[model samples]
Target: MSVLEIRDLHASVQVSEDELKPILHGVDLTIRSGETHAIMGPNGSGKSTTAYAIAGHPKYKITSGSVTLDGEDVLSMSVDARARAGLFLAMQYPVEVPGVSVANFLRTAKTAIDGEAPKLRTWVKELRTSMEKLGMDPAFAERNVNEGFSGGEKKRHEIVQLELLKPKMAILDETDSGLDIDALREVSQGINRVKDAGSTGLVVITHYTRILRYVQPDFVHVFVAGRIVEEGGKELAEDLEASGYERFVNKVGA
Candidate 1:
């Protein structure tokens, strides 16, 4: 089984030319294949930073501690190397790629990760099938990636990659942001498709619990002040929905 282990992961985000703002402070967590973990926290509590750090985002620097995937050092790998090594991060705000079509983008990504291109006939069929399952029109295959697409469309495209690439570990950074209920449910179903495969580890980072109801997590971690303050099962997420992060914030302050 695949394993992702984070130990005392301390990191800082580059704020300016010369300043780095400390974000993650001695964070520790672990995810095994087939397990879904939710990282919940208040705004600015370093939830996104953790995802970026694990994905080797250059903007987020790892000052100390270690992140490893199946005994290999993750922090040392380059961004592309991280992806080829089976780590995927769906950004909070996906950028628009003006020239690249969705079909070309997904095919190139799949080829890069697999170290070879897929058969043209089979890839096309699979691409259309994935989009249909996500409620996306097959014609979107010709549209530029996230260019002029709605917020829901961009998020759905991210999941399309998640399905095609089949990464060993996926960190969804705020997949539910800006999505209406209908869009959210569609995206969650796409995610559940991967979860059902039981091969990829899932780390869902968000401030809200709505998505958790659809993509129910096996472990719920309450993050505060750059570290996890409490952890429990799915019930903890329900409690957070009812009570919110105030108690966790106070516990951190205490």
Candidate 2:
């Protein structure tokens, strides 16, 4: 199994005219294939920042430390390069593209990642199957990419993309937000399908333990003040739900 490693990761975001506000401070974690790691924290604790930094977003600059995917420097790769190299980021708020249909967007992504367009006949079958797995309507494929989609619909669409794209590593930022109970179960099942593949490593960033109940994590990390303050097994999530992040926040002096 391959591992994605983050060593002493320190990142900053540009704020003022010439000032940078430090966000992540020395975040270190390793995720191996076939394992799910949950990053749980409060609002403004820099959980999203870590996801963006790992995906090489220009808004967050890595001042020190390294992010490596099986010994390759992920920081050196362009966004598209990172995607093609098997890194996937499912955004908290998926954006809208008015003109591009979901089918076209997904096919284009598959072509780019696989270095060749998949067969139209078989690709359609695969696409429909993926959509069905996510409990999405067959009509969703005809809609514009995330255009006017409800919160649950948008998230389910992302999960469909995740299933079809099949990236080696997935970073899901707040996937549970805005999901109804049914949608949450559907989305969690879709994620578990991907996890069942046994070749992808997953980092699920969430604020609550509800989602963890469906998509169990191998490791539960308590993130406070831009860093992981504590880590343990699935029971940690239960404890957090009962105790809340107050102790962790206080310990970090955040």
Candidate 3:
């Protein structure tokens, strides 16, 4: 099984050419294949910062600490290299690639990750099946990447990539943000399908526990002020949903 380990990861966001704003402070996390981890916190809690930093976003620089995927130095790899290493990030806002069709983008990404082109007939069938499973229309394959798509459609498309690429580990940043109830259920099912495959460890970052109801996390981490202050099982998410992060925030500020 694959393993991802984050050790005392401290990172800062580049505010200007010469300025860096620290976000994560000594964050540590570990996830194995077949496990789902949820990082929950209030706004500005460094949750997404952790995701982006681990995924090697240019704006977020790691000041100290190491991130390893299956014992390989993740921080040392380029963004594309990180992806080629079986790491995937479903951004909070998927960008719009106006000229590229969805089919082309997925196939190109899969080819890059696998280092080989998939057979055309097999690829076409798999792509259609994945889109249908995500409740997406077959016509979406012909549309430009996320161009003119609704919020729900964008999120569903990201999950479609997650399914098609089958990365070793995926970091989903606020995937539930713009989804309605029906859309949320469909997206969650897509996630669960990947989880059920018994590979592709998942790290879900969210402000609410709504998504957890469908994609239960094996571990729940309470992130506050750039650090994880509390950790527990699924029940911790329920408590946070009920009690809120007031106490945790107050404690961090205290």
Ranking by TM-score: 3, 1, 2
- Which 10 consecutive positions of candidate 1 have the poorest summed lDDT? 51-60
Off by over 4 Å in 2: none
Report the lDDT of model 1 for residue 25: 92
- Which candidate has the highest lDDT of all? 3
lDDT of 2 by residue, 1-254 (tens): 77899999999987876888999989999999999999999998889999999898888889999999989999999999999988999999999999999999999999999999999999999999988878888899999999989999999999998999999899999999999999999999999999999899999999999999999999999888889899999999999999999999898985
Tens-place lDDT per residue, model 1, 184-209, is 99999999999999999999998889
lDDT of each structure? Answer: 0.94, 0.93, 0.97
Q: How good is model 3 by TM-score? A: 0.99
lDDT of 3 by residue, 1-254 (tens): 99999999999999999999999999999999999999999999999999999988899999999999999999999999999999999999999999999999999999999999999999999999999999999799999999999999999999999999999999999999999999999999999999999999999999999999999999999999999999999999999989999999999999
What TM-score does candidate 2 get on C-alpha atoms? Answer: 0.98
In candidate 3, the residue pairs with backbone N, CA or C atoms under 3 Å apart (3 or more residues apart, or in different chains) clash, namely none
The residue ranges of model 1 lying beyond 4 angstroms of the native Cα positions read none
User: Candidate 1 lDDT (Cα, whole model)?
Assistant: 0.94
